[model samples]
Target chain A: MSASIYLDHAATAPLAPGVAEVMHDVLVGAPGNPLSQHAEGRAACAHIDAAAEKVAGLIGAEPREIVWTSGATESSNLALRGVAEFIGAGARIVSVVTEHPATRDTLSALAKQGVTVDWLEVDAHGAIDHDALAAAVAQGPDLVSIMQVNNETGVIHDVPAIAEQCAAAGVALHVDAAQSLGRLPIDVSATPIALMSLSAHKIGGPKGIGALYVRRRAPKIGVAAQIIGGGQQRGLRAGTLPTHQIAGFGAAAAQAARHGIASQPEWARLRERLWQGMAPLGGLLRNGRPETAAAPFLSVSVTGVHGAALITGLNEGEPALAVSTGAACSAAKGESSHVVRAMGRSPREAAATIRFSLGPGVDEVAIDAAAQRFRDEVRRLRTLAEAA
Target chain B: MNRGAADDAIRARFLRPTYAVDADAVDAWPASGAADTPGEDARCRVFLAVGNDGRLKAAFAAFGPPVVIACADWICERVTAQTVEITHTVTLADVEKALALTPTQRYAGLLAIDALSNAVINLGQ
Candidate 1:
């Protein structure tokens, strides 16, 4: 009867009320563009600057370092290009096999453009081997990109250790901390990260707005203004900043700073509840590590499950329960996750996989209900399938 | 035990006699879902199974001529002219529960729907 038990936080989080209210004020009242020179414009600009400062405080970066973009996809692009081109890093970028498609495909595109690409491999646990990182950086590429927390696996990489390696090699590092910033502690001052990408929607902020932290010194990756206009955001990303969304993102960021630590425990408890519920089922297999992995997302695959059918069935049978079998970006066509495949799961195992992601709103009761419904459905369907 | 992907996709929707499906599509199934090739003889019966990606998973039915009770989504390891014992179950759970029923050495396509634990396994020939 109420809102559905939303477990797919990694897909997109529900906006916080605090963020919503702030955004409402800006959208309803703010008139002139933040870029306009009029008093109205200056008022809007002040609102944007304040919002950026709040976001900067959470990540321990200067407000001047933050440049806004449409969202993570663009933020990621800006980081990769703005640094790579600015340094003219010889078109070769070093990274790992588990990078999100944003970085992976971007590198792949660069590879086609004669950029040398080197990738560090991860073990079954999704941990990057230090030896592999050393090897990938040995040749000295223009830039290296790594995501702080994996979206699907939730595996936390040693970004600082990685930063040290990049620093030693004199390679610029770009950390796609979209999943990490809100849930995990990030101190850009300590970490040798040159460029970092942040998305508002991922942290229960408004959708459309994301930011990039570009260190003035190591600005090698030059993105030739994908949206050239009034040269806003250090001229790297130029457009009329969505003041309302920025205000919402700032509110979300502030809320994230306040309640961030709660996310991990909330997810960990639900995840444990899920594993306990699934223990009796002989065929189920856990996908990745929780604490080391992304705490909010849990992927499990039963020995003989069809992932697409399972997701659809879960959505249909338990209206309050929502889940996914593969990457939400690739959900429309029923393609299995390449991220899982990189972890060495067979296609069948990958197909059987279901991603049970937890959000801030999810509680033990919701977890139990969803798990019970899932088990009941699974048992019923399997029994019937056996009968069929 | 379960409807084969072929059965699930075709069912009543695409099986009309006048349904304009490509002959190549018709050609994929030489001997499944019906008894005998379209023109071959009453002795030859069709078998239906889900095709994972490309190859057939298991034989589910042989409806034309009604030669014995059709075992759905089975490989029909033994298909004689008069009787076709569906050697395996169509769905995965029945296949697992009827473990003694299935031969130990056989390749099959097994996929469990995530929404439910019950698996849909198709034994390939």
Candidate 2:
């Protein structure tokens, strides 16, 4: 058997070059609490500050706006739950039905706590209807929370347009940019986005480290800290920050700034090549609007094959294909993708969906091999189904 | 479902189901019976041919998780050279034990038994 090919970068990307070295240096060399008054503490604080600058630079934000958190999940929790708490009960938040569970579940919890949530629906292509969004904004909700990119289908939401509507309505817009932070060019200064959740692991940084960008400019945003003990991070997120993880995140962000922007077209081309290779199978359906999808993502749902059987065959085949049936977080639930189901596909079709997300090292050769393995698995499963 | 959670027996059988009938040869079988669990999409079909000495030859085709496929293949391998009456006597426990199926995978065993029972009935008619 040949080596396995990894296409599940959406789940977690491998650490990029320079990220591990910085992390190692910080782990071995920097050994003081960032908030302590000692010299070592001051040195640690400087590292954290530099990392924040790099993270801020990637998204065109001031370093002061970045509030470090555990990861995107925590950042989202801080963004949504904190915003809801700040606005108090009876606050209204408008968000899409297909936001990541971090946002969706947080909103659900808030709804139970007396906040009214209006979940905007998406069309079959996983694209939100602008009119529906406009209507939601017209209601003057306190906040409009949406994701910049769909984790399951790679669908890119027009966050700028959404932000425009929210800004005009005098509403705060919180974007879960876990999937978009480095993969896409984001200028928070150019857009009126009030709050954004970001994760480092998704962009080849260390896991368990992320940031929530709280606008410090006009329409300043504030979130009541969910994790509070120490009065660190200006009391917004209170914890002794992980110095090495933060340093690694900054290095990853720097690398993304240096390479991620220029690599978009190449990634998009590879994605297209992958799709074209698998398109000949006839019953395969692309889950999102290709023109609007992120460059690294390609999600397809196959017909005429049992979803479970297909996944098994691909995983067990020689040179196993490392892909996901949906979001890795939800795959273990053994249920169809809610994101795909929300887009109007039946449960079975949603179950059959495969999300192939590319990363930095993936090339055309890997894409072709993955496509061939995908086709072979689908054909094999279809043949078995026909025999039955 | 957690594919790695499957036992080695199930993994081996699922990866290379030796008793699975080829799609082209499915039409040439003397008698075949298929059963599917409606909402779960767990399905199994058993194909049988009576040998010259009144014994049975069996092959299976399945559409479901690896457990279901492995269960169906196990059932076929168990009943291949047995008499039709013996095939009818194959129980759910028999299939479950052979595959080391868990409680969650009990449906695979049931589906296999149902398919084989139907095949036995069809062979009689």
Candidate 3:
């Protein structure tokens, strides 16, 4: 079939129809720059503000707390770097090695600049050790960044617990929450995070647009503003924001806030069917605790088979299927995900792992069919290997 | 084949696009279908049989009992204007065991809403 089964939701999700319609309407009706002093411009600005409010509402914050950025990378950088400069001085930043490259590299650079950094150890399941975080925060660091979810393994972290530790230390918590914002709940009141990243693409909004949740009255975690421009995003981010992207991102955030749980049942059902299908095959290992894992993702490793080959085999069928070996952004590098590595997997097993992510187009029928395809492909590939 | 015979002997099964399936039609065909026959050609489990640009785009596996495992495909007769989505590959043995039909019956064995010409057809080219 020409269509591949789409199981790559972690990389980016297909735009939901609701988000698409809103974007299309805004694109056609209001093409004005949101900052211009005209009726159309005012209308555009209103649309953007409403969208921002929608995004803020999802995380239980006021609209003004949301500062738009390019996407997860910029949002992440803004939160971490923003905190560093806002404090008007340097301090320690504790993060995990399992974090996305955005946070991982950000902290790495911070370390080079002599920022005290604590790269916490994770259990085999990729959970951040709370005691480690508590100890690190107890050191009186000014800023700490952690993700609400592990991108590759879909492991949910204890953001609230970590935030509590940071609060006790009078430290500001910056949650790279790009992965967990819509897939799971993230009420700022519950986590009380000083800074959190949000991405529209992850919630079916267009790419290149994200925002940071900056709490009012948050303790100063001064960060140097990287880009100097029109000072558009409340001096947090500068440059004329793309109205279309901002509008779309806001629209998607609103939708996620409203109906995020509606599409969840299908994912749970699909995962159950897939779990049953894959459980029978020997040498098959499911990576995370399903209950704690994200609804749409299931990372698994079949002994004696390369995850990439397995993906190819599954997609090579009718009702075309799609799957992935690891994070799409980093898959081309041919390295197993660092998140998987943090879970204590041997390099070979980690390399052989495949991630099956479902989204709007997926259902139990597709997943069950895919599970069979997965088994069939794994059997064929392993048999060939043994024969060779 | 007359309408009565076609109706009584064969019926088309409706499957989803690349839908999963397992039926009780494995008695009519030989043990190892095309791929495992150990004949001139070694069979493939699943891969693209036709380019996507073609009318019939799909992938499949030929297992024992002449079964077929395939992504969903449309089976249709232009004249009849009848179309059915073929989700799973039915094995020959499955046809025999499930329907208890013989080859002589022709279209009476494995017929769906789509085709009448090709009976016991596994994967489309």
Candidate 4:
């Protein structure tokens, strides 16, 4: 009861086992810049290369295709903006309305700069309609940007099918795999994704480090460099590489490749357990179809309770449950979830939604404790409402 | 007041709203007054009652952010067990001062005082 139960993994997961140690070793042992030609620099470059290979291995990409950036936000900005800049004015990009703000805001900025964008609407369950997507693709946009998974609802997009559609249409597809990297299998070789944005923290790697995979194969995708100076990462990104952070990211990716995929069924089981524990409350609305969502995520909106009060009660109660009402980025603004609203939920329902994203170290005990806390807070708030 | 500090004050009051009324206890009070500000996004209702001895008691139901709920809770606690005349004297300033409500939350104090005024008027009638 003293320790808080963490279920906000969609916001960021705890660092995987040995990731911190790997980072510590790199920080203490590697002191030279990777760009320098000295022996020390060569040593540093070797670490970066090794880390790159590990990360590339996870998604079936070559080490040369990985471009490191500052987490997924920067990766997304670089990918989308770079493409928009390369395509010049009048370039149209198709994406879903429910994408993370990193993608959405970047697209909005691109739109302001004269790039046309077609924002596809999602259905009530937060899944994009295939016919609408096909229609949009047939219109011949220069690029298609869609998240492999919705950060807020965990709704899995049919990326392989979408990739096929885009490929047939001669459109380059960019998938934001930030939330889906470890939770789902992604093979660039198997799927025709032209560009992919990845975040380390989402998969138990350190924060402040992410990667963008730019395909080097046939059809030859082109992306203009958004960050200038130092001419690093083939001038795609210029800042000096963070060796320790990259090392940690690599370790996390290695761990996920070795263990995370095999752990999905257990994650799924725990997610269902959590849902069942809270289901008896009777007025719960699952935000998206569970079958269509990633196994580690469950979002539910409560009826008969003040949204803010319910969040407060759960967060402040004994055995505090760490959960989010929406995307963690938007939660700080105290705004209702745009994702849920886009899914046709009323603002009130969106506000009352809680996203419980499980990751490493989450167990049945944690799930049951979180469920008990959720029930207690919902009942208390509902009773308080009834009395009033 | 700093927004974080104000939020902290509101959170403290919101987590333990001791004077919050329960539905089962409504029948025991003799005199009652209620007011509500209705909206799609933010809604609040305050219910006030006077004891047989003319002492005031209050409770509230709100569908708003923490600041509004905390304001109502603060007003109820401030006026509880006071004479009806004293309870009626509670003002927007008093609630605001107690809760350190932000400017956006100032409406909550006004809503609380309106409910209290209505209760006092009901008791007089």
lDDT of 3 at A255: 74
| Model 4: per-residue Cα lDDT over A90-135, one tens digit each | 8899999999999999999999999999999999999999899999
Over A1-388, each residue of candidate 3 has an lDDT whose tens digit, in order, gives 1365677777788887777778888888888888899999998898888888888888888888888888989988887766666654456778888888999898788778777788898887777778888888888777788888777778788777777778877888888878887888778866658888888888889998998777876653555667778877677788886877888888877778777767777787787788798777788767778877888878886666544444545554344457667542212233666777678776556666788777777776777787777777666656433311
DockQ of each: 0.04, 0.54, 0.02, 0.46
Instruction: Please say which candidate is ahead in lDDT: 2 or 4.
Output: 2
Candidate numbers sorted by DockQ from highest down: 2, 4, 1, 3
What TM-score would you give candidate 2 relative to the actual structure?
A: 0.96
- Which CAPRI quality tier does the interface of model 3 achieve? incorrect
Instruction: Give each model's whole-structure lDDT.
Output: 0.64, 0.87, 0.64, 0.84
Off by over 4 Å in 1: A1-3, A217-224, A327-334, B1-125
Judge the docking of candidate 4 as incorrect, acceptable, medium or high: acceptable
TM-score per prediction, in order, is: 0.75, 0.96, 0.72, 0.95
TM-score for the first chain in candidate 2 comes to 0.96
Positional deviation of residue A325's Cα in model 3 after best superposition, in angstroms? 1.9
- B63-103, model 4: which lDDT tens digit per residue? 55566678778877887788766774677888888777767
Higher-TM-score candidate of 1 and 3: 1
Report how far residue A383 has shifted in candidate 4, in Å. Answer: 1.5
Ranking by TM-score: 2, 4, 1, 3
Location of the lowest summed lDDT over 10 successive residues in candidate 2 chain A? A326-335
TM-score of chain B in each prediction = 0.19, 0.91, 0.20, 0.79
lDDT of 1 at A10: 79
- Candidate 2 deviant stretches above 4 angstroms: A1-3, A327-334, B1-6
